[model samples]
Target chain A: MDPVFMGQVLVRLLPPLGLTMLVSLTALAIATPLGLALGALRAELSDKHPASRIIDAWVFFVRGTPILIQIFAIYFLLPKLGLQPPLFVMGVGALVLNSAGYQIEIGRAAVQSVPRGQWEAAAALGFDRHATLREFILPQAARRMVGPVMNELSQLIKASSVLSVITLFELHKAAEAISSANLRFSEVIVVEGFLYFVFIFGISLIASALERRLSAAGALAGAGSFAR
Target chain B: MTLLAARGLVKRFGSFTALDGVDLDLNRGERLVICGPSGSGKSTLIRCINRLEEPDAGTVVVEGIPTTDRQALRRKVGMVFQQFNLFPNLTARENIAVAPRKLLGLSRAEADARAEALLARVQLAGHADKLPSGLSGGQQQRVAIARALAMEPVLMLFDEPTSALDPEMIREVLDVMVELGQGGMSMIVVTHEMGFARRAADRIAFMDQGRIVAMAPPQQFFDAPPHPRLVRFLDNILGH
Candidate 1:
C-alpha cells in the first residue's frame, strides 16, 4: 500500500471519525446518568417491589442480547410504531442501548461497593434511604466507578464503529468511501484503525489524568488520608 | 422528661439475636457511655435510639418523636461513627455542611460559615477544604464530630468515637469529645474507654447480650458495678 494513498485515506476518514467521537461523547453523557439511575434502582429497590422486577427484566433483555441486534431492532422497530427518529437519534439510541447495558453492570458494582453501614449510618442520621443514595452513596459510587466508566467510554468509541454498517457516515464510513474510490481497501483499513487508535488513546490519557486529579483533590488534608 | 427513650428494644438479625430486650432512657444534656462485649448490642441499643437499627419489636421515642420517622429523629439527634463516615467526595467543610444546608435550608455561605466555626472548634480550621481521604484517621473522626455539631443537634451519638483510632490519636479525638461533654451536649457514646467514661459521662450504662445490665452514675457504675458481667467486661476492656 502506498503511504501517500494511506495518508489521503486517513484525511478523508478524520471528519467522520471526529463526528463519531462527538456522537459517542454525547451518548456517553446520557448513558452515565441513565445507567447509574437504573442501576441504583435495582440494588436499593427490591425485586419483590413491582417496579424492580420490571427494571430487572429490562436490564436482562438488554444485557442478555447483543448490541448489533438491538441497534437493528431500534432502527427497524421504532419506525413501525410511527416514530421516525432521526439518524443521529438512531445512532445515539444504538449507542445508548449498548452502553447502558455495560453501564448497568458498572453502576450496580459501584452502588454495591458502598458499605452497607454507610446507608445505615445515613438512615440513623435522619436521611431517608432515597436521600442518602442521592446525596451520599451515588456521589461516592461515581468516584469509585470513574475508571470503569472511562473503560466503558473507550469501548463506546470503538463500539460506535458498528454504526457505519447502518450508513450513518461515521469515521469508518469515510474510510469505506475512500477505500471504494481508491480501490485500496487494505490501506484504508489501516488508516481507519490508526484513527480509531488515536481517538481511543487520546481519550484514555485524558480520563486517567482527570482521575488522578480528582483523587488528589479528594484526599484528606493531612495524615494518612487514602486517595481515591 | 426523657430526651430519648427505648422500650423493650428487641432487635434480631436473621437467626442471630443481636439485642434481646434492652430498655433505656436519656435526658437533656446527659452524657451516657454504653460499654459491653463486641456482640453485646450496646451499639445496637444506641443505634436504635436514633433508629439506626430498627428493633424488630419495640418502640423508640426521641424528643417526643417516634423513631419510626427516622428523618425527624435524625433532625433531633446526630451521630459520629468510629468509621468517621464523612462523605469522601465532599471536602471536610462540605461534610460538615451537608445536613445543615440540606436539612436546615441554610445558604451555602451560611453553611460554610457555620461549618468553618465547627471545624475550628475541632481544631481543623486549616483543613476545611480537604477531603476525608487526605485527613488522618483521628482527623477524619474529628471532622465527623464537627459534621454532627454542624447540625446543632439536640442529642448526639458517638459509636466508639476512639475505637478506630491509633493509640496516640485516641486522646486527641477524646479531647474534643470531652470538650463537647463539658459544653453540655447530650451524648450516647458506645466505647470501651473506661477512663473517658469516668472523666466525661454523667451516667454509665453497661450491656450484655441485648440488654443494659447496669445503669448509674459513673462513680457508682465503676466503683460498685452491680452486674457481674460489667465487672468482667470492664476488667477485660481495661486489660486490653
Candidate 2:
C-alpha cells in the first residue's frame, strides 16, 4: 500500500539479486550438460543396462524426495562424513542436483520424441550411431526441447530461493532480513514477490520467443509425415 | 556382374516371421520389382539388404563385401523409405546434401553443388530451400530420392517409396524412379504399382507369406504368373 516504502525494499532486494542470479545460473550451467548426458544415456541404453538402472534410480530419488531434504543432506550430512565444502558450494550443489533430475527427464523426452524414421534414415545413409545422434537426431530433438528446458530453468531460478536456508545471501534472504529489521513484512514481502514475478516472467517470455523461433525454423519436424 | 546376393535370409520378429528363407540376387544395373500381399515380407527383404533389419539367419553380400562390413554397405547401398523420411528440419537441398557431406567427406560447397544437381535431376531445383513440410507429397518423395542418390550408391533399395503418396502424386515420384532405372542404377523396389513394375523392372518377384512365390521377367510374370498364390494376388490387385 505504501509506494515509497516498497521502493526502499526494492533497492535492498537488488544487491542480493546478483547472488540469486549467480547461484541459479551456475546450477543451470552445470546441470544442463550433466542432465543432457545422463538423459541421453538413459534414453540410448535399454532399461536392462546397469548404468541405465543406476541413472533411473538417481533420478527417482532426487525427484521423489523434497529438495529441502536434499539441501540439508548435502550441507549437514556431507560434512558429518568428514567432507566439508563451502556454504555457497553446498547451496548451489543442491540446486544443481535437483534441477539436473528434472533436466534428465526433459532431455530424455526430447531425444525419444524424435521420430524413429530419422534414425533409420541416418542409418540408411550410412551414418554411424554417433554421427546419426549428433547430426540428425539431436538437431531435431533440440528444437523440441526448448520449451521444456526453459521451463526447467524458470523452476531452477525459483528454487534458488531455498538456498536462503543455508544462509547464502541471495534475494529471498535479503527480503527476510529487511522485513525483520524494518518490521514491514507486508511491504517487503510484496516487493520481493514482485521481483520474483518479473524475473520468472521474463524467463517465460524468453522461452516462448525461443520456442517460436526454433519451431519456425524446424516447424515440428518430428511431428509431421515422417513420424508415421 | 552380380552386385548383391542374399542367400537364405530369415528374419523373425518375436514369433511372427517377417522374412523366411528368402534368396535374392541383383546383377549390376538390374532393376527388380517386388510385389506381394501386405505382411508378405516385401519391405523386410530390402530392409535386410541395407542391414536395417538384421537377418535372423542368412548373409547379404554387396559387391562381394558382406553386410558385416557396414561402412562398405553404407557407401555402396542407398535406400528410400515408404515415409519419404526427409529430415524435416533441413531444407530440401540440405536433406540431399547431408549424407554426402558427412559420410563421403565432401566439403560443404561440393555437397551443396551435388545437392543442386540432384535437385535438378529429380526436377526439384527451384524448391531447394523449402522444408519437407512445405512441399507436396510428390516433391518430398523426389527430395527423398535425391537424398538417397546423393550417396551415389551402386545399389538403391526403395521400400514402398510411393505407398504413402496421394494418387496424383504417385506418378511424379514413379517418373523420377523410372528415370533412375533407365540410367542403370541397380534397384530393388518394393511397390504395389504394377504400372511401375511393368515400365521399369527387368524382373518381377512375387512374394507371399515371406517367401518369393514367383520370379520372372515382367512380361512373363504378368502374362503367366507361375504360382497359384501369385495368380490370386495379381487378380486381387488388378482384378478391379
**DockQ of all candidate complexes:** 0.39, 0.51
Candidate 2 Cα misplacement greater than 4 A, ranges = A219-228
Lowest lDDT sum, 10 consecutive residues, model 2 chain A, at: A219-228
Q: List the residue pairs that clash in candidate 1.
A: A16-A171, A17-A171, A219-B134, A220-B133, A220-B134, A220-B135, A221-B134, A225-B133
What does candidate 1's lDDT look like per residue over A1-228, in tens digits? 799877777677777887898889989999988887787777777769887777677678787887778778888999999999888889998999888877877888899999976786566556777878877787677677889999999889888888877788899877877778868789888878888898899999999997886667553221122111
The regions of model 1 sitting more than 4 angstroms off are A75-88, A173-183, A219-228, B66-68, B238-240
Q: How accurate locally, in lDDT, is each candidate? A: 0.82, 0.88
**TM-score of the second chain for every model:** 0.95, 0.98
**Structural similarity to truth (TM-score) of each candidate:** 0.87, 0.95
lDDT of 1 at A132: 87
Residue pairs in candidate 2 whose N, alpha carbon or C atoms collide under 3 angstroms: none
Q: Model 1, range B1-240, lDDT digits (tens) per residue?
A: 678777887899999898898778888889998888899897787777777777888887777676557688787788888888777777888778777877788888898999999999999989997877789999999998988888788989999889888999999899999999899888899998889999999998888877778888988998888898888877876766
